[model samples]
Target: MHMDIEKLVESGSIVNELDYERAMVADRKLRLLAKTNTHFKHLRNKLRNLIVEYEKRVWSNEDAVDAELLAQSDRAQLIIEKERMFLEKRKKIIQARLKDFSLTQAELGLLLGHKSKTHMSELINGIKPFTLQDLVIISKIFKLDIDSLVPKYLSIEKIDRISAVIEEINNPKLSKIKPTLLSAS
Candidate 1:
């Protein structure tokens, strides 16, 4: 297994084979995308189940009106929204990867066995949801091991900066408490 991974990473350097280089990079990109998709799918399912449970409660008793249930529903909605945004981001990354390889989106779509450029574009744009099987197909085309992709895709140190900014933005009280008294309002 380790040998296969090394082979993939070293594919770019194989003698007289530029295609190997392309394959290696594509493999890396596809693996990253598949990992991201898996994360999104798992989160989506969890949110879906929570929403279902909440709906069941509401349906069972019209007068129940659990404030906590309502709050959970709101949280579920936010999670879905955030996941949608994340999907879009992932699509953009995929598109960018195609661009980096100087491949037309249509060409990439073809490579991925997608005939319709529009549909392919939608996939690349994260406007369409892909089955896990589709992600596997993508990895096959790239010749990558799906298991090796997750850690690299999920480890993002910069997320802390973004989270800190969002935390400040969401807290009105914190916003009201100016960091510096001398700063103009």
Candidate 2:
């Protein structure tokens, strides 16, 4: 999702991990820009304060998550975190390759159809989604394995959908594996 970064700043809310991450990126960008632009200093401080408040709230709510919800939350969070980790790995590898090859962000941006360096940076930082075609290009150019570049974890919704399909098909082999595959879901 292309988060409205300034809107996020003005609203002063960080509900989830993605929101927190985007806000952090925005805060960092503002900090860097604040060196040249005096206007960004106030914005950076505001976001930094928000992040601190968010951390405090999270610490205070530790007891809210009980044992009953732990399994489900763990499953969901692991899937989500795994996806993020995969993207982070991709970003690092891509960055390393760019530096090693003496490639400019502009050149990569043009190839990926993101003319704006800012948008490219967002994509590189996993703040935005990349199209499948873009991933394909990255894979080909960077020699990164396709499997390592994408999410392998099935979301709960996807697990449920596949379970339903397996039930509908009723193939003996699939039937035998369905319960095992979807047990976590």
Candidate 3:
């Protein structure tokens, strides 16, 4: 199994507890065939790194964190953590509903336009993101709000970006929607 290294490193990268378990399972499977399998080793290592990064972010002072003070890479990792936290909530809801509705992963996967159950698993587990359209489809079919499918949270970078753009636009009407823009704040 090949890991998307570039994706794993990007701000968009998704790594979660399930991804770690999958990596460990893959590592074990690969090791049984070849102890020194480079591909599995690399994939496992990257997943470990991401999990470590996420775990380190849970400081007691999290509320005091300011985006401006973080280095670019730290900011990116913060985004990863934020995304993972929000996705975990949606994942829990979806998984429970799947069983309640007597639905198989493959069936839901197909509905989400994912022909491969593994890919669907990735999306479900937060190892990969679900597209907005995919989430909307799930919401419609499952009688869930799109917000419930993805409760709102903004990464620090996005918050800063919106703040900057609003400042640049200099539109007084933008002030009316400021609360919506920084909902997480």
| Whole-model lDDT values for every prediction | 0.45, 0.67, 0.60
TM-score of each: 0.38, 0.58, 0.57
Which candidate tops lDDT?
A: 2
Clashing pairs in 2: none
Candidate 3 lDDT, 1-185, residue by residue in tens: 12333365444334543333333433343343234445445555665566556545532266745564345445445444555556667888898889988998789998888898656765775555678799899998888877777646665546668878888898999856656753443
Please give the lDDT score at residue 6 for candidate 3.
30
Tens digits of per-residue lDDT, candidate 1, 53-122, equal: 4345454586776786565445434333444445555566556666667878788677767888655744
Task: Report the C-alpha displacement of residue 125, candidate 3, in angstroms.
Answer: 1.0
Give the Å error, residue 11, model 1.
46
Question: Candidate 1: minimum summed lDDT over ten consecutive residues — where?
Answer: 148-157
Q: Which ten contiguous residues of candidate 3 have the minimum total lDDT?
A: 17-26
lDDT string, candidate 2, 1-185, tens digits = 22555566688866654556556666765676667655567667777888888767653577865674455545545555555566677778888988987887778999888898766765675645677788889788888887656655555556668889988998989888765653322
Best by TM-score: 2
